[model samples]
Structures are given as C-alpha cells and as structure tokens.
Target: MRLSHLADYAVVLMTAAARYPAGARLSATELAADTGVPLPTTQKLMGQLAGCGLLTSARGAAGGFALALPAADISLADIVEAVEGPIALTLCSDSNNHECILDAHCRVKPHMGVVGNAVRGALGAVSLTELAR
Candidate 1:
C-alpha cells in the first residue's frame, strides 16, 4: 500500500531532524526551512512525534525539540507509526479490527499479519541514520 502524504512528510521531516548534531534541538520553523515542509505541518508533526516519545521538547529561551534516541535507534517504521499509527496492510491484519463484514469467511485475513509484519520489518530495517545520509 502507498503511504499517505502526511506520512511521507513526517519521514522527510524526521530525516532532517536526524541530521543535526547529537542532541541538537531545533525549532519547527527551522525544520520547515530545512525540510521544505510547511511550518504548520512541521509544528503539528513535531508535537505528534514528541507525544509518541520519538522526540523530547523543552521550554525556555533555549527550548526546542530533539530526538529522544540516537538516529540509529530510530527506524523508518517508528516514524511511520508515529504519524500513521500501526502499519497494517489491511483492516483484517489489525488485532483491534473486528468490524470487517467478511471476517467470518475471509481466508486472506489470517495471512495478512505476515504481510503486514513483512512490510513493517522492511521499514524497521531502514534506520534514520541511513535516511539522513
């Protein structure tokens, strides 16, 4: 499945963040300028990423945002999940999903987990360090 534009923007934003020196804090405007993402979208995404524990924020004259973990510790899957939730290829693959009308007779449901996991694994294999480069 194709990723949403917002998810793609999140990845672009995150890779820019990962380029800063270790523990370097950056503002949304700075990230927007660097990554070419809109300032408002960058601000919203920074909040979402921080809420998901991928980023840490501080308040004051020196306040800004920084990655909570090293670039190597963060993966493409983490960034995608931060903005797009879990990487389920279909509704049936999601554990909390029980609203599918074909749930009772769908043969593809069981195997969707493997497909979802494989997709997520492929994303997980790509680290932010690699993307930043």
Candidate 2:
C-alpha cells in the first residue's frame, strides 16, 4: 500500500530533524523551512510526534521540539506509524478491523498479519540515521 501524503511529509520532516546534532531543539517553522513541508502541517505533525513520545516539546525562548531518542533509536516505521497509525496493508491485517466484506470465506485473510508484520519489519530496519544520509 502507498503511504499517505502526511506520512511522507512526516518522514521528510523527521529526516531533517535527524540531521541536527543530538538534543538540538528546533521549531516547526524551522523544520518546515528546512524540509519544505507546509508550516501548518509541520506544526500539526510535531504535536502528534510529541504526543506519541517520538519527540519532546517544550516552551520558552530556548525551548522547542527535540527528538526524545537518539536518531538511531528511531526507525522509519516509527515515523510512519506515528503519523499514520499502524501499518496494515489489508483489512485482515488490522487487528482492530472487523469490517471486512469477505470475512466469511477469505483464504488469504489469516496470512495478512504475517505480511503486514513483514512490511513493518522492513520499514523498521531503516533508521533515521540512514535516511538523513
């Protein structure tokens, strides 16, 4: 499945953040300028990322948003999932999903979780450090 535009933008914003030295705090406007993402979207995403514990937000003249973990500790899957929720390619793979039209007789339904996990695993293998390069 293709990533939503928001997810893609989140990745872009995160990679730019990763380029900064560890503990370097930056504003959403700075990130928006660095990555070319819209300021409003970047602001919204920064809040979500902070809410999800991927980022830490603070107030004051010297405070802004910073990575809660090292760049290596954050994965592409983390970024994608943070912005778009879990990565479930099919309805069957989504544990909370119960609205399937083919629930009665779908042979491949049982295996979709494995497929979805594999996809997430693949994404998890790529770190922000790698993306920043």
Candidate 3:
C-alpha cells in the first residue's frame, strides 16, 4: 500500500531530525526548509510527532524538538504509526476497526494479522539511522 502524503512528510521530517547530533533541538521552520516540506505541514507534523512521543518538545529561547530516542532505537514503523496510526493493510485486520460489513463471514480477516505483522516487521527493521544515511 502507498503511504499518504502526510506519512511520507513525517518520514522526511523525521529523517531530517535524525541527521542532527543526539539531543539537538531543531525548529520546524528550519526542518521545513531543510526537507522542502511546507512550514504549516512541518509545524503540524512536529506537534503530532511530539504528541506521539517520537519527538520531545521544550519551550524558551533554546527550545525546539528533539528525538525522544536515539536514531538506532527509532524504527520506520514508529514514525509511520505516529502519523498514520497502525499499519493495517485491510480494515478487517485492525482491532479498532469493526465497521466492515464482511466481518461476520470473512475468512480472510483472521489471516490478515500475519500479513500486517510481516509488513510492520519489515518497516521496524529500517531505522532512522539507516534512513538518514
């Protein structure tokens, strides 16, 4: 499945953050310029990332955003889930998703967890350190 533009933007923003020295704080405007993502989008994404615990935020003259964990500890899946929620390829596979009309008889739903787990596992293998390189 294709990533939404927002998810892709989050990846770009995160990769940019990963390039900085550990615990380095960066402003959204700077990252917006660095990654060519718009200021509004960058600001929005920065807040979302911080809210989801991927990034930490502080206020004051020297305050900005910093990665909550080191590059090696943060995975692509974490970044993706921060902005896009879980990585369920099919609606039937999501634990919170119960609106599917086919849930009652769909035989494929049970097996979808394996597929989703595999996809998530693949993403989890790619770290921000690797992506930043």
What are the Cα lDDT values of the candidates?
A: 0.93, 0.93, 0.95
lDDT of candidate 3 over 1-133, digit per residue (tens) = 9999999999999999999999999999899999999999999999999999999999999999999999999999999999999999987788886787787898998999999999999999999999999
lDDT, model 2, position 73: 94
- For 61-131, candidate 1 gives per-residue lDDT tens digits of 89999999999999999999999999998877887956878888989998999999999999999999999
- Candidate 2 accuracy as TM-score: 0.96
Task: Work out candidate 3's RMSD over C-alphas.
Answer: 1.1
**Each model's backbone clash number:** 0, 0, 0
Error of 2 at 59 (Å): 0.2
Q: Candidate 1, TM-score vs. the true structure?
A: 0.96
Clashes of 2: 0
Please give the lDDT score at residue 9 for candidate 1: 92
Model 2 C-alpha RMSD vs. true structure (Å) is 0.9
Q: What is the lDDT of residue 123 in candidate 1?
A: 98
Q: Pull out the clashing pairs in model 1.
A: none
* Model 1 weakest lDDT span, ten residues long: 91-100
